[model samples]
Target: MQKIDIRTVDVIQYLQPLREGGSLPAIVKADDGFLYVLKFRGAGQGKMALIAEFMGGELARAIGLKVPELVFMNLDESFSKTQPDEEIQDLLKFSVGLNLGLHFLSSAITFDPLVTTVDGLTASKIVLLDSLISNIDRTDKNTNLLYWNKELWVIDNGASFYFHHNWPNWTEHLTRTFPLIKDHVLLKKADQLTEAAVEIKRLLTEDIIRDIVSSIPEDWLQSESETMSPADMKAAYMEYMTTKLSNIDLLVKEAADAR
Candidate 1:
């Protein structure tokens, strides 16, 4: 991720209350003079989102796009420990208190169903990666694209692989899901393609990914596997992750030639 412009952030002091959802999500002020999207280990299994988030955001940053500043916080459990209704607790499985900093940009960048050209390259890269990861969350409605410093940024990668735990057909290639691959004009720019490739290479070799994903804590993943064996989940992760890494190389090769 690009370092935050000093002018945009100062002392991250207090947190402002925002809308509530899976794990009492909030917007927090950061020391760098920016606001961060904060997720607390609230009443549900929200913490699992952090795993996807850190992994996705890290890969995205290595690819040379602008992603929000990320900090793995050790939150004071006192402030965020209020449990939700018992029935609600019984209903969900997620952790809370994951805070992600924002750029506090000057314009509005909506996840509009219509594709725009200004940041199309970055958006295309993100869409392509999401497809590889089976990220079912970045649909037309909640695609977390942002506008900062007159550039496009990708955000909110929490719901990826939500259904992969017991997915019967885990080996299916994910590239088939993207609807705008042909429409994004910026795909021609290919600015961050090589960078993305480097990052993908680093991640596939990292032992942490293999160690952590097995305990993927999403409610669906945790609950669905009790009736069946866990081998398919592992198989699916290997299948798509390898596909994503290979495409990263392909995109990087395209970028090297384009420039």
Candidate 2:
């Protein structure tokens, strides 16, 4: 299992609002003098989005994928006063505590699968990772990829862990099959799904799976039910991921069948 240490930084300046998805992440300059795509804790999607971003990015990194460095960005209430947009002001005011940040890739262009061709091994690995995490946002409509400095970087995985949204019966859906992967943009290019499956199984060991879920901040694991504490939620996330590891073959076959 690989270890990850999350870096924290103070958001010194709000450069601009991204306003893309429901979360409405913003581009900001941190005290470290780097621009970051900051995902607010007060967004409609709540802290679950941040959990998905951190957990998904870390998993991608562990499997040798290109993902921007993630940081815990601190935003002060005073910072909201500087924004003229009333809506953004309210968002910042509510997200005054801790937020998740993705290192911004300046001038990076959105990847178009039709225009660019990816290698078989890399494509297969990416498909496998998305399946393992149950990421639903990597379809052709939204690639969630950026081409920076001649490399394809994966980004925006807040929609990966949908299971967290319905925690009450999460266990019943643990073995649920992901049939939507047929729409994955890279499915056609991933000719080595079988080989990728072996690699994914080797990389995502039980200990590695637990370590990944444990890295999530306890504060983000807000309980939706009285019986579910933050620690219990974290444990559930671990169990969910580790259990999903055994079902990768189903996902691979689904993608292969789609191809």
Candidate 3:
């Protein structure tokens, strides 16, 4: 089994807020002297969003897609107290523990499907990955994709795997065809679904899924359920993903039919 480990960095300074999203993620300088887009744990959608972001980004990387590096960011209580803005300070105060961050892409531009064209294989892989993870944010209006360094980079996966929000019936979602995949921004360009499936299956194995689920911090899973422990939450995620992998053909068919 391949062990997946995420680097932990202490946030040194909160630069500014990226106000586009509801979470109010900020660009912060980490102890490593690098700037990262930090996702607050206390934001709307809570730590579940961070877990989704972490798992989704790592899975995208595993499937040969370009994703910004993800790291575990530590936000100190004292650091939150120094912020001048009331709203920002409140957000930081609630997010004092561990949060998630992505490496800041210097000059990345939002991917405009109308202006920029993507190849069939790349589009198919992205579509399939999004469908597998149940990501609803990658639509025409909000393509959570970036064009940087002459390549397409995936980002902001906080909306994936939403079944966790209603844990009582997570299994019901495992077999879903994800009909919303029709709205995927890359659906029209994804003509190579079969080829993408073959490659993705080869790369994403059961062991890899297990490693990704295990990497989620226990603190994030604590508030999920009183009856279900963190370990139980991890197990649920593992089951959800493994079941989704086994039923990948359902998602592929859905995408193909949508196209």
Candidate 4:
């Protein structure tokens, strides 16, 4: 909090009757500047939800996508709402906590999902990205996508990240393969799933991976350790990345053909 950049911000406020159930509270700056969607530590989904949004959203931005602007802040615990999911709420009712700054789209002005933002090709790219990252979110209907500023903004990555280690444990982990690239947008002349695979292949690095893992807040580490154990999750993630890199050619061709 030394030198400032986004100085135009006013006071951050919360809205009522928030749309989503678990994540309702938002850090809304005055005069429609921005809103930060803070993730809470409920019973079922631990801090992994926060990690997924922060890391995945950052990765998407790094890969040249129009993701919602996010900021990592140590906001007051009052900013987030406790889970109403009876099971989760019951378990964590004793240990109320603050939040992990991974704000979502609260703006009403964002683009329409069909008209302005992404199409098949972009979706396919997202699918490829998810597969490589072992992301269990992104579905045809659920948490699939969002459109803003004529470009799609990706969100709801809780199913990925630290949640991977809980794979056998998380009963809701999605296991569907993706569609072909030709069927996707293809971007007319820019359709190059093959090249993209190769590119995605090259982008992987130990540093990038390390940066991702290290970015997760330490307090988010579970006390029980059985849920989303970082070590196990890290190994699984390593294996997942390796497999994706190895099969880059195959996946790209597969996507292209399916399209």
Candidate 5:
């Protein structure tokens, strides 16, 4: 499998904190002269959330979905020294290493399901993607979707693959039906789930899965396992995803039934 290439940038400035979620992700300017929304490794679920975000975003892009460009953002301890708020300073102090960043969509608007009309195929594909990744945050209350340039963009996938939080028996979740599909924001419009399944299976090949899983930073996997090395963790992720892909039909049926 060809290795995936993700760019790494150093954060030069902390712009502001986006206080919407518990994670307290912030907008920061990187050395590359661009602004990005940085997900801190020190916050909420820590590096595991970044791992899930990377996997979810890359998988979505592999299947022809619009996701903001993901980058490895390096944070320095000095950035925290002059911070006014104790909470923000403490967050930066702890996150003084590699964190995940997404390219900022300057004029993007939050997707409001009440006013937005998504087509059947698009909605079905989104539903399938969420089901495969086991993302539970895309409800009407916290739709993580954005509208930019008249197109839908997926964002904040840190909530995907939540099984990693309790890593003892992660395999048991591979073929389990995603009951949370009933709460997905797009479930009502997902009429072309069968078609979406076929397309996802075609696009999200083993090579793609391997490439994405391999791209996960070793630091993120370090504290997650005591017996398993980072390499072992990567292999486990590959296995989980491949098993999930093979059982896509079960996910499709569950999603269709939920609607």
Candidate 6:
């Protein structure tokens, strides 16, 4: 896999608020004249959520999953003053610097597995990728799958890589199996867990892993704890993910059992 680059885009307009999730991500128009579902760093989740969005979404796209383009959105402080809603204003105020943006799919509809038939191999790949990242947002209740341009597009991976929230104990959780596979929307649809595992392992090379980890902004990695600098935190993430990749067999087995 080639090294992936994270682009930085400036927000030109804040169109409207997407009231779907607790974080209150908004559909904002960027300078590129593209609409993006912007996940604010100032919202309830903070910088950890943005890191997960950057890392998890990239990993999904890296392994052949159809994820929208992920970019670093620049939000200016003045933009928040135009909003009348106190909640949104506070969110923008808090997220005045860098935020995560998901390229908005205008004509896409939510993917409901009951009405659509996803191939076994594709389903298995999605499940395996989600498991590797420990994503908890892709359940039936809110299947993050979007049917757009006649293909399924993965979105909103902010809930993944939750270990970053507790960096001190990230090592302990590195080898743990993702227990949420049982309720995964695609568990029954997937039958090629082993094949998917092989493909994932092959695609996630060491250089690719490093690029993903370093793709995160330096500001996001800042810690009040003097023990772990931003560079150390970045190394920690790379180490943790590479360890998880080696131990993916356990997760594959867990997914198979759930199926």
Runs with alpha carbons beyond 4 Å of true place in candidate 6:
225-227
Better of 4 and 6 by TM-score: 6
TM-score-superior candidate, 1 or 6: 6
lDDT of 1 by residue, 158-207 (tens): 76655443355544544434333333334444456555445556644434
TM-score of 1: 0.55
Lowest lDDT 10-mer window, candidate 3?
Answer: 221-230
Task: Report the Cα lDDT for residue 199, model 1.
Answer: 52
lDDT of 4: 0.51
Q: Give candidate 5's error at residue 103 in angstroms.
A: 0.2
Q: What's the lDDT for all of these models?
A: 0.49, 0.87, 0.92, 0.51, 0.92, 0.89
The deviation in Å at residue 174 for candidate 6 is: 1.7
- Range of the 10 consecutive residues with the lowest summed lDDT in candidate 5: 223-232
Residues 167-246 of candidate 3: C-alpha lDDT, one tens digit per residue: 88888897787899999999999999999999999999988998899899989999724577889889999998888888
Model 5 steric clash total: 0
- Put the candidates in lDDT order, highest first: 3, 5, 6, 2, 4, 1
Clashes of each: 20, 0, 0, 9, 0, 0
Candidate 2 lDDT by residue in tens digits, 224-245: 4536898888888888888788
- For residues 97-180, write the lDDT of model 6, one tens digit per residue: 989899999989999988977888889999988898889989999998999888888888889988888777878887788899
